[model samples]
Structures are given as structure tokens and as C-alpha cells.
Target: MVRKPVVSGMFYEDNADKLSSQIEDSFHSEFGPGKLPSKKRTREIFGVISPHAGYQFSGPGAAWAYREIAESRPADTYVMLGISHSGFPSCTSLEDWETPLGTVKVDKAFQAAFMERSGLKQDETAHSQEHSIEVQLPFLQFVNKEYKDQLKIAPIIISEEQRCKEIALSIAETIKQTGKKAVIIASSDFTHYGMNYGFFPFQDNVRENMHNLDKGAIEHIKSLDADKFMGYIDDTGATICGRLPVAAAISACRILGAKKAKMLQYYTSGDITHDYSSAVGYGSLVIE
Candidate 1:
């Protein structure tokens, strides 16, 4: 079965050629790596933390992460962890995903193994309307065009941060048993500020404070301290959308022998639109 794109035209270009061009533009945008990805791979990456927002707002951040992955060794599978804004319970979908560029296969064996090991429920309806995971596919297709047909993903929706470690360990175990070279991508957006989101800590210097808030959390992620990352979220009440997914990625990547992480990009929609009144922050990172 195949899951159609839920936010294709709304969040990004829906037409095939237009979508392809839009993705390329993102890679060359000012906030992006400022260049197209190369085939040379110097290091290995195990996980990625990407933002889920309209491509116009979050694409540049995602471009940075994808650029690194494009150059790194191509993995057979991408374990995608996303947050369903609909508040669905933590679950997995065994459905190939369709994008404007192409269809992404689902690693059914991997999904089955993970569900058995982690007890993550299988539900296609959970993924039917979520944009978090869908937005990343075209970018993946662009970067891995050489192996586009081989693109496969295991999509999981995370709803509880407390259960992140347990789920992550199960994912690590599944990967070990399957012997598939895999990369885990946790999609998230950081620090949703403004009264619109009902999260306002400071009255003055809103823009500066926003940067500081997101940077604090990024520091913990770079250090690979999942506890500290969760604590930072709690202590500050930062409205990060995919906190659970990121926490689980930290645990899984660490268990899989990833040493350190690099912050690919960090900026807010305000930076893009020049309107900080009601903007969400976006951050991109790679764990290696």
C-alpha cells in the first residue's frame, strides 16, 4: 500500500518538476550550505534531527542536514520518527510513501521487527495526515537520486517523551539483528514562540531570547545528553514539536556507536519572514 503526500502543494511544490527545482533552490539558498551536494563522503552519519515546517521556512535547515547525508555513505534504510500534530499514540506505518518526486518504499521487515520488539502499534491512519514525515521525502529523493528506487523508510510517530529510551533501544536491537545499514531521522521544530502558540517567556528582546532558548537546547543535543535535553525542555517550557523523537534519536544513535553531533543550521521563520511576532524556530543537526 502507498500513502499519498498530505502537504505537498501546501508545504512544498506539488508538481514533479517544480518540486525538483524547489529542492535544488533550497540547497543553494542563503541559509543552506550555499552549494549543491557532492558525491564525496568523508564521514559516517547515524542520525539526523530535522525541522518539519513549510519548505519555505524550514527547507534551508533541512538542506544542510541532507547535504551532509548526501555526501555520507548511503544507508539501506531511513528510520523516520515524526510527531503527529493530531496527538496519535506512538505507532509505526508499513506503507510506502508517495512524493511529488517518487515513491519511497517501506521496509516492512524492519517495521515488523520494530513493532514486535518495541510494541509500537501498526497504523496507517496515524500517518495519513501528518506532514512532519512527508516533508522530508523529496529532499531524500533529490540527494539519493542515484539510488532513488532503493529508498525505503520505517515511519514511527512519537507521542510520549518518557518512553523514548525504551523505544530507541528496541530500534537499535532491530537494526543489529537485520544487519541493514540504517540512518535514523527525527523530524522536529524548536521553540514555538509568540502568544499564538501560547508560549511567551520574555516580553522584551523576543528575537534575541528566541535564539538563546533554542541554542540552549541545541547545546544539550550536541553533547548527546538526552536527559539534559529533556530537562532543558521542561525547565524552560520550550514548545519543541518533536521532543520525544529527538530524545529517542539521541538514545538510538548512542547505542549504535555514534560519537558526536554537529549543528547543521538554526534559524526561525521570523528570520525568514522578518516577522518575529509569531514565528517558530527550526534547527538541523547530524549525529555521527
Candidate 2:
């Protein structure tokens, strides 16, 4: 058995029934469940960008992607690549991530192959308390009920730009070799809007500016232009914490024949709290 849920009571409801209701409520409240578009409208998801903030702030944005993933034929595994805030040389850390819904077993066979091919060591410290990876679990549980029993996940915490690309490419290679349809999620929040994030150029206009930047970022992803993506961040100083993950996802998606990237939803914490002075950006995308 996998490790039990560690962040249920704190990050989300600890009670199973309450958690289920809340997750479903979140999905409907954020994006109307009744009006969910047909799966044919969106392309297959090779990778998606989700936020890592507390559920109160980013859960809705996270739900957009999770709901979409759930509607599609369920996958046998999920590969999550998250950002690392701790100071350390970049490496892909591994662990069996848990949630109150149930534990998502790690794919040991795939993990062993990934390590042998990528030369990245298995470091528990990378995932011990990283919120980026943990924040995506509840959405997974809500989207896939069989997650606990049938689905497995490979959790990798990335700390450096080069390492992020290396790991992403290695995983793409692994997927191709294994002939498995796996969903990859890159958890990150967009520009942190205020003095707290050190990116207050827009002042009260931060919210408007962030929406524009997010649009531009989504466009770059559509082109699968890694150089353009990195350049976009460099040029804007946009403050996206998942820069590497975004870039790598673009690269991997392009190789997989993803022709277009559609922005499913984009919003800031201010949308929820109405406090524009300081906020975080959240966006969800689907690559077809």
C-alpha cells in the first residue's frame, strides 16, 4: 500500500464525504458542470499547467484541467512535474504522492527506467513538503474515482531549468517506448502581483497586465516554441514560477503532434478574493 494522505485535513477537507462534495462543488462553481463542452471540442492533453496555491485561491483553475482529464478516457498513469522552491541543484525527485481520496501508487517499473536513462537520482527531500506536487492530488481524485485502485502516478519535483528540460524529454521518450497514454501536469502559479512577489510594475493594473501576459504565454505554447517561451519570460519578467515546466511541456507536446494549445481558463487570486493589491495568476491549457 502507498503512504496515506498527508495534507487532507490541512489543504482540503479531511472527511471523505465532505471532501467529495466540496470537490464536486468546486468544479460546478468554477465551471458549470452541466455545460461542460464535449470532449471532441478539446484536443488530447499531453501536458497542462496548473496552479499550486491553496485550494481557496487556485482550486477552481486546477479544476478546469482535472475536469477535462476526467472526461477523457481515463489513463492508467499520470506524470506530474512540479517546481521546487528549495535551494538545490536541479533534479527530478520521486515519491508516492498521497491524498485523502487515496494513494496514487508510483510506477516503479517506469521510475527505474527513467532513472537509468536520465541519470537523475531519487531524492526524497525534493518532495517531502513541496506544495506544487501535493496541490494537484485532490483534483486527480475528484476526476478519476479509480485513481486509488487503478491509476498510478510518477511525481517529479524539478529545481533547475536544464534539469526540467532533461526530465521532460526523458519522460516523453519513456511514454513513446512504453506505448502508454499518460497525462503530464506542470503545477505553477503565474505572476505574483505585488510587493510580495517583487513584480509590482503594474500596481493596481497588475491584474490586467497579468491576463495579457498569460495570453501571450498561451500563444507561445501553441507554437511549441521553447526558445520563444524562454524569451517571452526573459522579455516580460512575467514572474511565472513554472517557466521550465512550461517550456518543456511545449517541447514534448510538439513532438507528440499537438498542433494547437487552447487556454481553457485564466484568472488571478483577485478574482476570488477581490483583493487586487497582491494576487497570484492561475491558468489551464489543453494541447491538441
Best by lDDT: 1
Positional deviation of residue 202's Cα in model 2 after best superposition, in angstroms: 1.7
- List CA RMSD, all candidates: 0.9, 2.6
* Model 1: per-residue Cα lDDT over 82-187, one tens digit each: 9889988899998899998989999999999999999989888989999899998899899999998788999999898767899989999999989999999999
Q: lDDT for each of the candidates?
A: 0.91, 0.72
List where candidate 1 sits over 4 angstroms from the true fold. Answer: none
Candidate 2 residue lDDT tens string, 1-288: 344554667767888788777776666665323333244424356767777776766777777777678767666667777777775444554456677666677877777777777787776765775667787887887666654587777777666776666776887887787778877787878877788878877755666787888778778876778778778888988889987777767777777766767777888888777788888888887665
Clashing pairs in 1: none
Highest TM-score scorer? 1
Q: After superposition, how far is residue 101 of candidate 1 from its true place, in Å?
A: 0.6
Q: What are the clash counts of all predictions, listed in order?
A: 0, 0
Give the C-alpha miss distance for residue 250 in model 2, angstroms: 2.0
Candidate 2 accuracy as TM-score: 0.90
Please report how far candidate 1 places residue 214 from its true position, in Å.
0.6
Candidate 2 wrongly placed segments (more than 4 Å):
1-7, 30-43, 92-94
